[model samples]
Target: MTKQINLPFDDSGCGWYAALAPRPDVKRLQGRQQADYAVIGAGFAGLAAARRLAERLPEARILLVDAQRAGFGASGRNSGFVIDLPHKFALEHPDPAHKQRLLRLNRAAIGQLQGLVEKHRIDCQWSHAGKYQGAVGPRGQAYLDHFERLLGELGEPFRRAGREELKAVLGTGHYSDAIFTPGCYLMQPAALVTGLARSLPPNVELLEESPIRRLERDGQGGWILHGDEGSIATPTLLLGTSIFTQEFGYLRNRLLPVMTFASWTRPLTDAELARYGGQLDWGLTPADHAGTTVRMTRDRRLIIRNTYKHVPRYGRSTSDAMREQVRARHRGAFLARFPQLADVPFSHTWGGVYAISRNFTNFFGELDQGVYATACDNGVGAAWGTISGTLLADRAIGAGSEQLRDIEAVTGMPSRNPPEPFLGIGVRSRIQLAAWSSRSEL
Candidate 1:
């Protein structure tokens, strides 16, 4: 059996969270309560699930619970790219149909999020800036060529650019070539999530800092969730807790928790901006999977994300030593790309968790009686989480739709991982090997 989850909260500040203005305080779950439906984990997916449920069943008493404040976990800590393209490795799947399904789902997710942002008038610095898949060297360039080929097969539009074009757009000569895909949006993740949580329908109750300790089926055909301060009983439950779902022993070894680190520099001064001339705000993903991800924010801050580790447990925080090591790596990557900004230092450094599967798939559906789940984002959390949550809610309510079918067909449950100790060892070894191989790109 999987061990119980002790939800981890990162004390190190997230630049995105710090950038946002203070939000009004939210209430925490106290004492026992009963609801018609309970949605665990108030990240992107849980928020979407609870909102959809509220819209579909206006009278239903829906409870949305989170271990920490809304947007304070992986949802707020991400690099804030709502991508509409398949992951670089996703194209490697032999089935072209699978790739197409992925593209459709990703686009659908982007559409859903766009609608919410517009309807609610979210002020999260949302922008349709698209993104660049940049290549650092020959190997990275080859990866870009493969991506372009895949894009062509999918009939997607992209602009191929060489060193000069990339330099003009990114203000750096680090990348040799790149493909610009115009379907991604950049935003302030923390603000977006918190806004979404606040905007949830009146039928839903938002409860933060309520970590579920255990969940079990009640004898009366309902579910009981035990948390630190209180418990909740509901006839139906939807879980969007990502890797923390292991507490239910649902996917167990199949879902792996990989932690990635990111850091953000303070806004550049006018002179610094002039020295680093380029488009004011842009985002770039690396052609190499293990390479660094860079984003120039609308507020003139530069963010860098790279490095990965396997961490199954939640409460254990990233050590100061590891933070320093990753910080050094980020510094090196930033200087390599923008030598002129070598003196600028990062204002904040933080880590986020991603639930990955060996087959690069997701787990969505009813895992048990009256218990539904949508998780395992495979490193693309923002979009995947949104769509999965919406679809899962539809499934729970017995509402059939083409999108749900597509998601089910494309993203079956992840394959089971190897047993315990060996599984951890293998995952760590793979991460180390990949990091070592991508040293130059870093």
Candidate 2:
């Protein structure tokens, strides 16, 4: 009797999703269906899990369900960095061996995704252009210094750049110093996700725009996922629902969902691009945890992602006023970096939610006899989510691998959070404090 209380929905203003061609007809679940395996999300993790299941159990029927079209949710709305190294937040891991293990997992994810992109010939603007970790002001510089030291300790290859060097390529002197790592890849997130969904194996059936409304035990050792128009009964289920996993009566207050906003400018004209004077395709992540993420797309658009809000009510949509305020903040960030393109108008703006835990560890194991979950991507959703989902499938099939063992060794339960009003107050206060401390980077 696990009822889904809040339905997840995204606004129609994601720049990445809008830039792509129109989607084909979506097939919603129509009747009571049965499958050997059922996956509850179509994002990176769910897609990977479904695909792995199909590959591992070719004779088995698999069903992949999503509340929205593939890539239209957080997957499509992300900053699009398939990160290989540990993120700024991940630096908190006290054990160097643990960090190294996570790095190997992240790189393995990149390899898997790269193979898929090549096999499917995904039209997404995939590039090995790497990434720039930039810092602003004193606090940000200190963070970058520590990050650089950690990179060296990990024996990773990176080049340090000062203000002038960064300005020559980024066309902005806003950054005081930066580190460039060549191990990351950048792409159009929505395109990559849509391609992956469409290219799933023959044994896997994908149903979009099908929101599961309720969950019931099937008397036997199975589960039933009830949707508005149909239902799915399966012996096995994997929840890659991210923050929405709470609605399924698991994780509850243990997870924290934070909404982040991003806005992308309309394609820059040839003259405008020349005036901006930066590499046509590059990505920058802020050194400070709360700073902005900026990107220049191959399609000649500029994207700035910043601002965070704690929106516990997933059923309620963000108000027009709040979105506008976020857009305004994005505009200011854009102008600060590229004042030369002052007149460039943003094509679309939207918000996406990413979940985190108090201890920064992801949930990656079974919750019940027949139910499994892999959520809380922290900040490296593209890589971490993919590896987690793939490994979860392996573990589900009772197959053992060194990779799975490493993930299990590092993955731990999230620290328990306080209840209700106290939890909300604490999370909001932390967000505000971080925002204030990293104001310069923002």
Candidate 3:
């Protein structure tokens, strides 16, 4: 049996989900349930996968299960940018052709998500206002220059903004330089995921607050997923559980669970909003990977996200004390950027988990007979994860396309990581070095 040691639970300090209305009672799995296909985890990937599978196999009974309510985990805790270009921190490839393929895939995801939001009339405050990649010091500027070169090579249009222009647009002089790329979208991530779950096809049954505790093979060619109150049997299993996939006895030592924290301030008063002379809503990504990400919500709240920790213990390591320390860092970063709103208090703070691979490749294929998975999306889970999950459904049914081949060619396989203590030491040290190098940007 594959035993799960950790699970995705609600982080009460998540402002994204807290800002929304309460959900109705969850339908947890009970007794013996059967599904033709089971898609685990209700985040971006699982939702897309289940939706796609349901679309193709209209007669199939598909189960989409999650440990907590939809959008209460990493999916909702993100900085909420649906980026359309290759991420700066993703594995670097010198081939422009490879980069172009990635760009196309990400854009395709954006288009797919846009269609659903419009069709369902999801009220997620969706925006196509673009995003700003900013630099605070010389090191960050150098990274931004590299990013600009990559953008140019990909034939993507971008506008450069210096200090004064950035200040005028963002209402802060903290950023020395920035590039505005007009293809990205912004929205409340939690709302998007929850809406997607609610709007799934009639054939898919979504079970929330049902944590799969263990997995064991059935006597036949199927598998049995054991939960606290019930079990599920399915001939086909697809896991989109992010880092938690390791607990199911696959992809061991091939993925890293990185913890990142964010803090959101209370809604700005009319006077405070006037004092902050920037656009009403805007998102800024740091040129340095370790720097801070800042955003102004449509509802007039400011969000500050930064800091990384390699927590092998997963959620067990994110204690209240640790969250408090991270929140303090966020407060410092927020004050540095918006000192005019010195009295603006943070209303929520939380830490989230996302998986990355040593070689920057996600697992997106069959793990064993009758089993498949799509995990480790690096940091671009919003777009890449969505597209990958959609394609994974197609691949599971023996379907093929040029897009599938392109993604497979570029994302070969996740490289194996070192064992235990060594791996922890290396990752933690690297994180510290990166943070130090990007200190000014933070």
Candidate 4:
């Protein structure tokens, strides 16, 4: 018997969602609907695909569906970094030309999002303040050195900062050294996704609270999507559901749903800010891949993300024991870095699912006749998903570009995963070992 997959969005208690303004009401799919093209998921990829489809086929009906409101899923739950460089620990492309091409694709994604945000005047607190990669000790410094060398080889500009300089910027002396890269943009993730959903072309219809229970090919040469309240029949379909695609038997063992936790503290008062004493806003990723990710938001709240678990069920509701465990980890990381803010308490904690593949590539291409997919974010969902969505849209419409070619060269279906019982055992053990190894950084 096949194991049933649980929905990741069922109970993601994201602090980013609560921090944003109240979302306007959106209509859910209630009855039978037909469209020329339908995009499922409504995340970074789905939203981008729907908007691009609308632009490409003005007369064609486009439908965008999601299980919950826009930005309520992983898209909104991210740490808000629109990274333009390769992820800190991702495998580097062996060929210099291939690496340059990949960087161009990342920049294109950032450029596309920047254009959209500016054109729509979205009030998502979009900031050009680049990010810092901070190292905690000898191990972290070694990782930073490797990262710096890769950046130099890629011809990317980055500056190294000493301990004092990092303390001034990060307000924490825990990091021994740092590298600042100016290509990243930060924003309130929930706000940006919500705004993007709202600004989608008028021709694209967004239906929320419409969880797709099943999808099948219709006998009449189209696709039938069964939702909680309705069904949709469309000629063309795009799956941007990320790891949830496993529920449909799409990526099966080829993708793993990794749950990562993040917590946000209550906004600090003026006196508390003075006591903390650092730049009011900044984001820093750990030099070590498993180390904690910290951010000081524009609203004076501190955010910390750490810990990873391989959860096959994709259930978003974490147990109280697990929550407390993660909170303890978060508190330890926070206090170790900023003892001055020991009194501050985290207002919320949540887990989000990210799909990882063994080879660190994406599942991007046509899966079947009239069916397409762009999943497996490889831990850089914001920028990568956006670009993949745009390129997938272009591919569906028979339009080609240099960007599409570059993406095609690097992306494909993931390698198969180990079978169940052992897969779980191995993944869990690996996560535990990694966490243990990076305990000091966390």
Per-residue lDDT for 19-107 in model 3, tens only?
88888789999999999999999999999999999999999999999998899988888999999988865526788778888888899
Candidate 4 clash pair list: none
User: Candidate 4: which stretches are off by over 4 Å?
Assistant: 1-5, 10-12, 89-91
* Model 4 Cα lDDT, one tens digit per residue, 296-350: 9999989999999787767544576887899898898889988999888899998
lDDT of 4 at 255: 93
- Residue 156 accuracy (lDDT) in model 4: 91
For candidate 4, which ten residues in a row score worst on lDDT? 1-10
Ten-residue stretch with the least lDDT total in model 3: 88-97
What's the ranking of the predictions by lDDT, best on top?
Answer: 2, 3, 1, 4
Please give the lDDT score at residue 116 for candidate 4.
93
**Could you give me the TM-score of model 4 versus the true structure?**
0.97
On a 0 to 100 scale, what is the lDDT of residue 257 in model 4?
A: 86
Higher-scoring candidate on lDDT, 2 or 4: 2
Whole-model lDDT for model 4 versus the true structure?
A: 0.87
Per-structure clash totals for the candidates: 0, 0, 0, 0
After superposition on all CA atoms, how large is the RMSD of candidate 2?
A: 1.0
